[model samples]
Target: MLRAAVIGAGHIAKQHLAAIDAAPGVEAVGVCDLSAALAELTAERFGVTAWETDFRRLLADCRPDAVHITTPAATHLAIAKECLEAGSHVFVEKPIATSLEDLERLAAVAESSGRWLVEDHNYLFNDDVQQLLRLHREGRFGDVLHVEVQVDLPLFAPGSRFVDRHAPHPAMREPLGAVSDFLTHLSYLANAFVGPIRSASCQCRRDSPVATGAISEFKALVDAAFGTALLGVSTGGEIDRFRIRVDGSRLSAEVNLFEVGAILTRTRGGPKPLIPIRNMVGRGFSELRNARRSLSRKLSGGPGPYEGLWRLVAEFYARCDRGEAPPVSLDAIREVGRWVDVITHAACDNATVSERQPEAVGP
Candidate 1:
């Protein structure tokens, strides 16, 4: 069995641990966290052999073949470097690094150490997304016209970690604050569907009283070589949701990331008046199918929440065993990192200019 360990036993850390446990041919050797209680609790739940407060000690004692870093973004660079140099593959959470320079450095280290450094863009492996990719590959979806991706999270909800004042989340320290946190997902999803973003424009604002100075709403329009994409990130919605809609030359499809199904629409070949009716019937059928699938999963307790994360972990382990490249290549990481920088920087710059503007005076 391949020995695996985890660091930073926070909320998401549990998911990483669970994925590690579920993956075949992998064993959770240890877990580490700044808070001994959190680490111990997580280790106990996962049935890990050991828990530590210091990662270096875990490295020495457990001697894992791979390390999963579920810590804050600020600490990812250092932790990943140490793991890679220690001869352990590193699997880190999204936005592996906030800056392009840091991504380059990590890539170099991974190359030198002959270890794989994979980021957790697990949404790419989501069931809905996988189905969409399969459709595209099967020649069912034609040339892409545009893509829209939206993620609305409850960052400012009653007990959200982001709203904690004493020890604010690392995302709150980012240039765009909490809004920048979800942009990493948007960047990769858009790049995957619409292609590389050539240029971009953004609109951002800070309107949530609960969120204080963080940007609570953001939207962007990016131009890619072949098409364009519209992306939105917000913390204002009552329902936390993630969804994507792809418009292609031949048909259009929409997938709700929170759910496990997709709806595809295309031209209906029938009488003019019946075309609309046929389209409506098609959508109804799709919804019924989705409802059935969702219910089945719920009843069977099969692939519950974060199914993509589980799939990603399994695939990563399989690739490592076969001596293959990671799911997200170095070049792909660099591309996503570059776009993330562009979008976040643009939003921050816009916020700065807005802050500097003088208020309207009585005329």
Candidate 2:
């Protein structure tokens, strides 16, 4: 069995631990966190016997074959390096590194250590997304012409660290503030559907007063190898939504990540006058089927919101067992960081230029 451990016993760590448990041939050997209580609680909940307040101690004592780093993005680089150097494969939460330099260094260490390094691009593994990818791969979509992705965040929710009066969340310290936390997801999704980003133009806006100079809205138009992409991220929205739409030569498809639903459009082979009505009925049936499938998944006590995470964790372990490539290739990881870097620079530069514009002097 593959022995795995987890560091950072916070909100996301719970999902990682659960994935570890559900994955076959893998065991949650240890759990670690700065908070001793949180570590113990998480370990106990997962039936793991070893719990440590110090990551070094866990690494030495448990000597796991793999470690999952669910800590804040700022700490990912250091923690991932340590895990790799300790002769353990690493599964790191996204935005594996904030900058290209760190990503390159991390990749080097993983290569030299002969250990796997995988990023938790969980969204790419979502059921709907997986289905969409399969369809694309099968030529159902022909060639992707355009892709659009949008994520609406609830950063201003009561008690969220973004708005914390004291000791705000580490994400609030990122270059893009809380939005950086989700850009990795957007980047990887874009990479998956649109290919390597050739160029991008971004606009940033600060509509919420939560963080000083931190953008609450981000929009980007990108040119890619396969096609064009429009990306959006907003922290000022009242309701959270994650949607991805792709237009192709033969069909168009959209998926609601939060709701786990998908819609596909194509030209129907029928009388031109009747095609519209037939397509509408087909869409209605598609939605109904999606709703039923989602309901069945929920009622069956499936992975729920973290279905993608579970699948990713499981796939990583399986790949390790087979001595195959890591689920998220190092090249893909670096590409994601590059995309984040470009978008961040573009957005920050735009914000700075906007701020520097002289105020109107006219009455």
Candidate 3:
């Protein structure tokens, strides 16, 4: 069994631990956190012998085969670099690093160490999204014309600990605002369907709770090789929700995160037909209960979303074991980071971007 160490005992870390426990050929051997109490509690639950407040000590003593860094964004680069140097594969939470430079450096370290590095972009591993990608690839949506993505969330809610004080604090605020956090997921979708983004224009705003609360909204016209794409994100309002629409000839697919599944509309020169993708069944409280039960199964060592991510992780590890190329190369990730920089710069400047290109559908 490949031994693994989990750093960071926060809410997300629990999910990581659950995933590690469920993942085949892997065992959780160590747990580390800034809080010794938290580490001890998690270790006791997992029945691991190693528990410490210092990650350095855990790395040295445990000598785990892999390390999962779920700590704050600011500390990712340092911890990842250390783990790579120590000859352990690294799996880092999303927004790999704040700056493009740090991302490149980490990539270099992984390359030199002959170890694997995987970013935890959870949406990329979602089964529903993967099905959408397959449909796009199969030309179910003819010659992609335009794309729209919107993700919104209210900051102050009971389960909004994911968007709590740490959210407004410097550590969380500086690395990335709501745009980067949400766009990391959206970027993968845009690239998967519309192809690479050549250029972009965006607008952003921040509000304080006392004064209508801090909010960031952005609209970007992304230039894709095949066509053009659009992405918009807003936070600090209403409950959590997202919608993605891809319009094409003959058929268009719309997916709302608030909804269970995607809707496909087709026009064949005569009439429009609505086709519902029945991948997700049930609705109302039943739907919520089913979702919770599915998640619970995954968390309790059964197969689920985390299993998919673990499979990807295992694929990377397998590549390393065989001395083969990683499934997701560093160059591809760098390309994603470059686009991230572009969108962030545009948002900060509130710039309008336009490019002369092939005629594409848009608002």
| Top candidate (lDDT) | 2
lDDT of 2: 0.85
- 46: Cα error in model 2, Å: 0.8
> Mind giving the per-residue lDDT tens digits that candidate 3 earns over 162-196?
35654453233652355566666677667667776
lDDT of 1 by residue, 1-363 (tens): 889999999888888988888899999999999999989989999999899999999998999989999999889989999999999999999879867677777888998889999998889898899888887777676888899999988788878878988888888888877876788889888888777667677897788889877778889888776688889987898886788998888778998887768888875477768877877888999999998987877787555658889999999998888889878888788778867876765675663211121223221
Ranking by TM-score: 2, 1, 3
State the local distance difference test value for candidate 1.
0.83
In the order shown, the candidates' Cα RMSDs to the true structure are 6.5, 6.6, 6.6
* lDDT of every predicted structure (CA atoms): 0.83, 0.85, 0.70
Each candidate structure's count of clashing pairs: 0, 0, 5
For candidate 3, the lDDT comes to 0.70
What tens-digit string does per-residue lDDT give for candidate 2 at 80-148? 899899999999987787776777788888988999999999999999999889988998888899999
Reference-based lDDT, residue 207, model 2: 74
TM-score of each: 0.93, 0.93, 0.81
- Cα error of candidate 3 at position 91, Å: 0.7
